[model samples]
Target chain A: MTTVLHSRLLNDVLRDILSPYDLPPVEDVTTRRQLARTLLSGQDNGSFNGLALAYAVVAFCTSTEDGATEVLAAVGDNADVLVLDGVRGGYLLLPCAQDQHVGLARALHDRLGSDVWMAVAWASRRDLASARATAEDVLRIASCRAPGVYELRNVLADFAVLRQPHVAERLARMIEPVVAQQPLLDSLRAFISEDGNRAAAARRLDIHRSTLDHRLRLVERLTGCRPTSPRALLTLSVALTAHSTPQVPLPRAY
Target chain B: MGRGQPVLFDVGRLLHEEFLAVYRAAAADADGWEDAAVSVARRVGSRLISAKVPVAQVVVALRSTDRLLTEAMLDDGGDARALAAAGTALAAELMSAFCAGDDDGLADALLAGSAPDGAAAVYTVALVRGALADRVVNAFRRHGPVLLATSGHLLLPVPEAAALPLCRDVCAELGGEVWFSVAERPAARVALARKEVDEIDALVTSLGRPPGVYRIDDMLFESAVLDTPEVRDELDKVVAPLLANPVLVQTVLALLEADGNRAVAVRKLFIHRSTIDYRLWQIEQLTGLSPVNPRDLALLGTAIGLSRTNALG
Candidate 1:
């Protein structure tokens, strides 16, 4: 079906799904995500011609019908496909096995070549209601990747919370006491970001593992939350997301 | 029954009837009558006050005769001039009333959580994005007679019947890109409803969810907590570790977004379940909070929300 046709159908399904929530029917992308979440929890449709696939991959690529068709064709008969429009260009949904993900993405890019640039993000019954939400994130992180098959995992680091203004303010303040100890904060950030991989975080920071440990201890002393602990790191990660945000402007005198 | 008392009674009765007639007539169609009515009332009310007429006595006299006066005015068959004059008398009596009953009614409704029987419903409108702010404000003004604003949100005190229509009109006029939230409280108490609307607005925004009119009950706990600076700061510390690795932070957020359903977080993040496990482990290792644990998950969810709120903004 055409992207518009699929989107309309999806919107109808979403509305039906969201009706229980009693939210005013505002047809916006954000609302769409909300509805999609409800569906992701297990709204069934025989139209996909399968009970469920291991994965649902979404792609934002060239708008041309031929480009989209070629991309879908490259996914082979193993998957069910749909295209959604009324957004940034067009979107493609291909539900397939995790095993087929890499091969399909590669084939599509190979066939479309430079004629189409593709950004892919995948979802599953476990977490994603639809690949629609992650497509943008994938597209954004796609910039750091060369033209080829790129899963969201490969470039997950590219998506930081600190990039938001309000968040950054809160985070900066949360760590304000320790912020002056630049080295310590830096070590903690690297350690957490590297998924607590001491060697990796040390390498990224160009510090010895022992020094990283020392800095981490300092972080513990300041925040009362050790850097190496999951619970503490979780808090630290949230605070770090704040760093990307632009400084909050003066509060408006309402 | 005394000779002088009888004459005085007749004059008072006639004046009271006249005042009631004008009031009923003007109320039937109040257009262009307020100025005349208020002026006449103020003149007469002040005069009576100056003449040592007790405000209570004047109000009681007006109240006792209101029904009879209204009946006479109705019998006049839409006589605008007489109606206008009666409105003036009524206004005078109203002014002389010992207290502002209507203001008191409003105050009662505003102060109470549940609206009193006659209180109108008030709503708080939050403008999330500024693009259609003017149009939305204008739309509310056009449809609702009373619009109150304080600090952040627009307070619309709408008649019961006007409530739904005003909401529909704004939605239709602005189109969907406009981000906003609407929640109703007692018209007098709409200012207090600001918290509800603000929470919903922040919740929806943090979730990267769509804009719509929402009730206070629609707000999610995670969204509400993250929206608060104090709570967000505390939660920020919990998730601060993952911030350096944006990807990992995103993973925790996805997990939190999925309510700690590892499989779901993996899907939202578009990563493998194995990857989700690894990240969850990393998160658990660094924070001593297991994604699988309900309490730990809630904490992580809060941190995720706090992060998303910032990132989305």
Candidate 2:
């Protein structure tokens, strides 16, 4: 009887340890504030090597009022992840090493389903605030990607262009005239997507080869960027990307 | 005070006449009088702001001044550049005073320029449009002043904590069709916040998201993928052939809209199950993408969204 009771107690403890939802949420405002302060101040907290921050936005088919709750529950107790209230969703902080960041993000994505866009960043406790900002930037640059886990490294080039919004705006304007010409825009998009295989592009558009050539020439004439040249193609491609990217205009002082 | 009124009126008249005179002089001489014209315009701007005149009225007055100056300069065959320069100087000084001299405190300061004093507080900037914008403006006025931006958009600034609930309540009260684009920023960056919210609205609208509240954070994926011309191009290509056959296109859209449930799509399309099956197969054959597959369905959904936006244009 004694041996059986001990065995049963051991099983119960193991169950608590293995369960992802074992850790109750940090519900007290004061406790959460203290935790945030401690993590942000870079004090040596024995539980974590670094903080992995994942900022996400979830669009629900229904009302989004409970989005934060859903996101928090989805994050669960995995690696002592803490969910803080944010704009549309929540900020999830995982106390883990660098190598586990991607896996943690993936797990969150799986739990949250397809409607969530998340960007993850790993930083030392000292850089926690900056990491959060970086996560936001990652979200912006990777906004075009399918809903999943994204990192700054994956979107560095796009982020670089977006950082200098004026340059990006100018690049976008370079293709403004082309945007109005649907046929030309379509041709350019097709040609680029087809890797400059004119014949393949023509087939994709279901247009004659000569007609495709005419459209390409019109694109070049209007945009001053030759489609057939490799260097100009790179410019055109970046311009197209910039044209679609949202820009934050500089503030004006009266 | 009564005697001062006519004196002010005479000063205004004298200033107007002097502006015309200087414009005429500069048109011919192209020197010396330009500075005088600028100085006179600056004084006029200061006087207008001091009188607490509305910016719109000031703009109208300036337009009339510009027309008169232009006519006078034209009659004298004056250099058009000189008249333009003077007009710009007048406009600049008026705008500067209108922004800087406003006594309405934080709202006015943020609208005119950044405010370091308000930097400690985070503001949620809301941009609303459509017929509902008026109602929203009326509702938002209880919290703070609402700025009327161009194109009938209303800009409302509220505290960060109160923003979400307030916007949600407003949206609910007005119904789900009402949409608001909101951005949270520090007081010093409210100007950029306006643009940020506007961009969010534009992006989400283009993606065919239902009318509701949207923020930059909520629109990351849609802005990243649906707005990217390259991705749209690729997706458009996938559906281009299907577009030639409206029946097939409709069938595919129905399937996507139904979330790939064949029975639901069949009911929605008012077609038999076999018909939807055949169309799905046809779509797959034409686009080399299967609608039954989850991954392929997402791509097709985005492709159709792009197609619809393009068609609307």
- RMSD per candidate (Å) reads 21.0, 22.1
**For residues A51-140, could you state the per-residue lDDT of candidate 2 as single tens digits?**
223212211111253644566666554434554544454455565444456665776567663356677776655666666655666665
Docking band of candidate 2? incorrect
Estimate, for each residue in A1-254, the C-alpha lDDT of model 1 and write its tens digit.
11111322354334334442343233444543333344344453423222233344455455355655565455433213433432223444444444455555565577664445455654554444434444454554453334566654333322333223444455556666777778877887677656767899999999799998888888876755556554456556555544432221111111
Number of clashes in model 1? 43
Candidate 2's C-alpha runs over 4 A off are A1-254, B1-113, B116-120, B141-156, B159-161, B226-229, B308-313
Task: Provide the lDDT at A236 for model 2.
Answer: 66
**For residues B1-313, what per-residue lDDT tens digits would candidate 1 score against the true structure?**
0111111233356447445434654747756555555544544443342233334456566655655565666676655565545644565545632122222233334434444433433544443453444566556544432222334355444422344455656776777666656666655555556666777677766655445554433333344354444346545665677666777666765665564556666677777778777877887776656666544554565566567778867
Q: Could you report the DockQ of all the candidates, in the order they appear?
A: 0.02, 0.02
